[model samples]
Target: MNRGIPVRLPIGRGGGGISTIIIIAVLFIGARALGIDPMEILTGSPTTTTTSRTERTAANDEAMQFVSVVLAETEDVWNGVFQAAGVQYQEPRMVVFSGQVQSACGFASAASGPFYCPGDKQVYIDLDFFDELANRFGASGDFAQAYVIAHEVGHHVQNLTGVLPKFNQARQRMNQADANAMSVRVELQADCYAGVWANHTDQKGLLEAGDLDEALNAAFQIGDDTLQKRSQGYVVPESFNHGTSAQRKRWFLKGYQSGDEDSCDTFSGDI
Candidate 1:
């Protein structure tokens, strides 16, 4: 599960408020109510100004190394998978930022969490979110961290396969509730794809004991229902852009057990 460090790009101006992290989920849930495009909120930028903040520390360096290793492992697994299907896998870039970053989709703060920009085919993350995952979400472990990276990479896969663009087109014709439902399917499939990567690593003996549990726990922790209930003490199924805890866990487990990309057909089923 170890690999040499890949290139890491640090891009951030300064730290944002701790409340910014809470706003990420709230924004996702309330986007339609507030007349904001959920898709744009998830992937695009706000007003942005570019400035370099290259401050690095030993802890951040270590985090970068871990991220690089996990990303490389994903590349290796996905390359083999795609090659077997007679398609070439295009590796996506991983940007490690501290507080904020500018992406092809738009500008985002660390509070936005990790996102994959299909526009630039890169994964953006604030490494501090891993700490949030451990402390706030209570999903800790290296494999849980890997699950996050792999989930974003799954978005890249969707982009390459035309899933994202097709969904975007479909959403344009739908109402807010319908569009949010579609988004849930998309996000659930990505979770399944992350599980597919887990299956590959497990096949190669790269996963250790409790690795699967860690990933499953992470999946459950970040489910839209779970997040909403934790944040607002209630659940709104109509506003859920991501799947529920049971659905997320089920889809991820399905992919892990099947280890086949085709098994992640969350769109066809009642996800």
Candidate 2:
């Protein structure tokens, strides 16, 4: 997710001749729609919330175990990839919170969605989001959840590879449109990395029939275009920090078919 403004503009696909103030206003509204404080996005001030851990019921326990197993699988895959490349992979910690959580990046609610914070080399997720993923987004299946975790882990890989740091620094100098375009590449690459993981998992005979469909559906459901259309009835391509549904699915399929990290590069000629 684009942590800067976290906006979902309702305007048309391109922001031609749109004023800065208008853009800011739309961003504020978008943040509000996501249950985030607009002021927090503007002022970079953290929200203070007394977050209690969700009581673990039988179902919650099962979900936790499932998440742990998926994470472990990612670790094994990335470790082997890094080892073969003569680099050490630093595993990231996962924090599964309830309503809210504090992280090195900043205070984030469940509304912020799952994110990998390069600041502290950690991934934060709210299990409730998985329910939302299934019921709200219509992307149901355990493999969809696994795809989410793997995508965040892919961000960790970007951090380790210096891709994220370079993007973060370079974005400071870019206009909103340019930055959003760049962010789409970043997010798509992460999706591709998740596909690479899926390929490895399949090789181990862990993926069942329909598993790839589950992941692809998840990617399509969460694409910027799809989400924008569902939420606001329109898509603002200029504000699409994540790729469109087609782009996301295509890149992921590319990675899965190739099963090579080199094929996951989205910084080249045309994404």
Number of the top lDDT candidate: 2
Best by TM-score: 2
Worst 10 residues of 2 by lDDT: 7-16
Could you give me the TM-score of model 2 versus the true structure?
0.81
In the predicted model 1, the residue pairs found to clash are: 45-106, 45-107
For each candidate, the alpha-carbon lDDT, in order, equals 0.71, 0.73
Could you give candidate 1's per-residue lDDT for residues 86-191 as a string of tens digits?
A: 9998877777666788777777777778888777777877878888878788887777777888888898888889888787778779999999898889888998
Off by over 4 Å in 2: 1-52
Clash pairs (backbone) in predicted model 2: 13-237
